[model samples]
Target: MRRALNIKNKLSFIDGNISKPTDSFDPLFTPWEYCNDMIIDWIQHSIGFEHRLTIAHADIATNVWTDLRERFSIQNAPRIFQLTKAISSLVQNADSVSVYYNTLKSYWDELEIYEPMPLCTCGSVKTLTDYNHRTKVMQFLMRLLRLYSGSGSSI
Candidate 1:
């Protein structure tokens, strides 16, 4: 998932941002994935946690893309699209979401759905004065997850 998140670090200088220069270093850069079985096990031990929600809930992965696009409206639309596609690829498509795959492939090309939403937080109006965009999107995703999961289960 990190592969497509484009985390876009913003150079924060909070004391803990950078690791202390300790003599007991394990090489400055060895390209770690942070994927440890123990981490997953620990997180699973929580009371309410399930698989990271997949982009394709049921047979309609496009629903997620459309919902995210409409939610962001301007900023983050493209990012959200990419993130959803990544989730779809990682979960539904098993890492491949090309059009050649047909049907579900359309979800992969969601990045081009509307020429990519602006990443810059410019002078764009908020999606709502009653129900903000982010909240709506979260709700939409939750609904889709619930509809497919059929048990209000996480993921």
Candidate 2:
């Protein structure tokens, strides 16, 4: 959704790109209205009516998205605690190596989605990417079962 909007150059409208118009119809009027309509339609179809009501007054896609994010993606203490507990208790007993890794990756991915790493104003994310990779590597090693104890000591 975001990629498509960006490709259409409509993303700026939602991200606070404003312009002053002297006449009734501004140059950005049509496209901006189009983008907002599309976003509202998407929200209505993807989310139920109850959720749609919360964003009904939002005139721009950004406002609607921000409201949705605040309602759904405000990661708090309890969610963090649950994710940490799940990560700490993960095991690789019955599953194959690939399965175990995939499961762990899913949890890590969810954690990331909820608590995204901070990015600079210039959009640089290298540090966050590297940190996530290192954390995943360490998690994989730490969760190995007792059968790999001898091999683990070599590391």
User: What are the TM-scores, per candidate, against the unseen true structure?
Assistant: 0.17, 0.61
lDDT, residue 8, candidate 2: 67
Give the clash count for each candidate: 0, 0
> Alpha carbon lDDT of residue 115, candidate 1?
45
Judging by TM-score against the true structure, name the best candidate. Answer: 2
> What are the runs in model 1 whose C-alpha is more than 4 Å off?
1-72, 77-100, 114-155
Q: Which candidate number maximizes lDDT?
A: 2
List, residue by residue over 1-155, the lDDT tens digit for candidate 1. 21222242311211124332345355632211132222223323431333334322322222333443465456556576775755454332232223323433344345445444445455453333224445433433443322344433453
Q: What is the C-alpha local distance difference test score of candidate 1?
A: 0.36
Please provide, for model 2 over 1-155, each residue's C-alpha lDDT reduced to its tens digit, 9 standing for 90 to 100.
56866786666655666432346587767765666787667666778777777776666667776677678777677877888788889989888878988988888888887888886776568867787787788788788877875665576
TM-score of 1: 0.17
Clashing pairs in 2: none
| RMSD (CA, angstroms), candidate 2 | 5.0
The Cα local distance difference test for each model comes to 0.36, 0.73
